[model samples]
Target: MNSEIFSREIIVPQSAIDARGHVNNLVYLEWCLEVAEAHWETKANTDLKKKFAWYVLHHSIDYKASVFEGEQLKVETWIANYKGAKCERLYKIIRLTDQKIIIEAKTDWCLVNANTLRPSKITEEISTLFV
Candidate 1:
């Protein structure tokens, strides 16, 4: 596992399927957040978590292909870049069975003071953890 890139595998769930028999678009967004949160929580120390939090500023996703229930997927994420209080994280959801990228996305996030809930500059300490 590359320290900079976080990945996890999951089977498409029935609840994520829509009437079209494919995973709903919104579910992709959910997966993005889930993976990002897991990466942060796993890497950050207790004091880091208590001092800082992240909030999504924007999400941009591309649906490359549809996936059905029970299809296995490999979700991967990495920080692309950071500036001031914000950073962009990139995602790729791949169909593991076929090795095809089903979804591609990027999310802009803002770092905030956990107590004040106001934007805070992303220091080298915080940015280096993900990059």
Candidate 2:
């Protein structure tokens, strides 16, 4: 269990842009989920995955700038904090060309039992893996 920030670079595809000529607002939400899943998959082992699952409870995003197709962006995510059954995950999307922040977001996730799909308390062992 390591506290490390996970990052991935992505190019804005044509399909991601809306009629307004910039990346769609919904696309940003999609990116948040994409980065979060990638980060979790990299850290959670097979046994952990089988035992626990995460469900998003809430999300907040701040759009700083608009992005267009072909633009390269870096998406970064990390587990910010956790208590009891819930934890917060943070995200940042930065445009590569000018180093502008495109969007910043926070998502609240609840740990749950894989089979029962019920809320599970995040014990010390599980908390250590993220925080």
Instruction: Give each model's clash number.
Output: 0, 0
CA shift of 13, model 1, Å: 1.0
Rate residue 58 of model 1 by lDDT: 98
Task: Pull out the clashing pairs in model 2.
Answer: none
Q: Where is the poorest 10-residue window by lDDT in model 1? A: 1-10
- Which residue ranges in model 2 land beyond 4 Å of their true spot? none
Lowest lDDT 10-mer window, candidate 2? 122-131
All models, RMSD in angstroms: 2.0, 1.8
Off by over 4 Å in 1: 1-3
lDDT digits (tens) for residues 100-120 of candidate 1: 999999999999999999999
